[model samples]
Target chain A: EAAVTQSPRNKVAVTGGKVTLSCNQTNNHNNMYWYRQDTGHGLRLIHYSYGAGSTEKGDIPDGYKASRPSQENFSLILELATPSQTSVYFCASGDVGGRAEQFFGPGTRLTVL
Target chain B: EQQVQQSPASLVLQEAENAELQCSFSIFTNQVQWFYQRPGGRLVSLLYNPSGTKQSGRLTSTTVIKERRSSLHISSSQITDSGTYLCAMGRNSNNRIFFGDGTQLVVKP
Candidate 1:
């Protein structure tokens, strides 16, 4: 089975604090993505990486940053957390080609106080 | 601009009943994918059909690429199938998937 894991499944932080959400995938897929889900809005893409050391901004990338240190690991960084950023974050891995499927991680619930 | 929109924001059905969910997109997308999410759970890929129709078990999905629309049909719906159904589309080479708000389904016993 294609497996994707995320760390700090739940967290609570103060405003202006730094928060880092980590994800690791064992599927050996070439693509990784970060998304946040909020009420009323659908899952919005924050950032994605094609390969190691390569990252690209998605539609809602304004408040987030992504790092792909290796093919199996991807991270989402929130340098200055805010109350508005509190939400459930999901990490997914996929094959980079057009016909490939993406597998999602269990997701992390973060709350900024 | 590219966008994916789902219809009937929510639905309630009795077990053994059939349910149909609709999705439409602005502009032509290169690919379409359907996902299911349980309350406080992860998003699971239910189907990926760029065009035409495909079936797996009790779920069937059809995507009309040229018409920029897709539909997911669930036959004999069960309580276990209750969840939010999401429709997403991929445009251009970026591989970014735009998603709809999802249709929340509740299946009564």
Candidate 2:
């Protein structure tokens, strides 16, 4: 089983402020992902990484950046947060190849004021 | 671009009643999965039936790849089963997965 934990379970940020949501997984999976969940929008992938030092843009990557400093860490950064960016964010990891199972984190709720 | 759509945006059920959830995709995919999520809680994978029928406990998932659709059937629903059901499709081996908005379920005892 994958153990995906995220830091700062809750957050509140002002407009134009910078926010960074950190995620850590102990599953040792090769892939990691960041997503935002909103009403009627479900989960939209923002960024993903294959391994350390690798980041790829997902479906909705605007106004967001991702970092994979190590196999156990993946982070989502909002350089200049806005009210429109407020939503619950999730981090996941897994092997999408054979026997695919993508494990999800508890999620981080970010509120941009 | 790929899109996953779940029908009956919301549902209400009584104890011991049966429930069915549907998921349809706009693109062809061999990767299909079902998940359960409690209000403000983490997601729990229910089934990973990509192209066939699979069952786990009282839950059954069937996928028709050619139709790009899948269905999840839960027998004898319980209050503990009240939550949102999500459907997702794996885009690639790198874990590129897309999810539907989800169908919120409320079970009354």
What lDDT score goes with residue A5 in model 1? 97
TM-score of chain B of 2: 0.94
What is candidate 2's lDDT per residue for B20-105, written digit by digit as tens?
A: 99999998788888999987788888888889899999999999999999999999999999999999987655557778889999
lDDT of 1 by residue, B1-109 (tens): 4388898899999999999999999878758889999988999999988889999899999999889999999999999999999998886576677788899999999
Clashing pairs in 2: none
Q: Give all candidates' CA lDDT scores.
A: 0.90, 0.90
* Residue A91, candidate 1: C-alpha displacement in angstroms: 0.8
Off by over 4 Å in 1: none
Q: TM-score of the candidate numbered 1?
A: 0.95
Clashing pairs in 1: none
lDDT (10s digit) by residue, model 1, range A1-113? 47999999999999999999999999899889999999877688899999999999987898788999999999999999999999999999887667546789999999999
CA lDDT of B42 in candidate 1? 92
Candidate 2 chain A least-lDDT 10 residues? A94-103
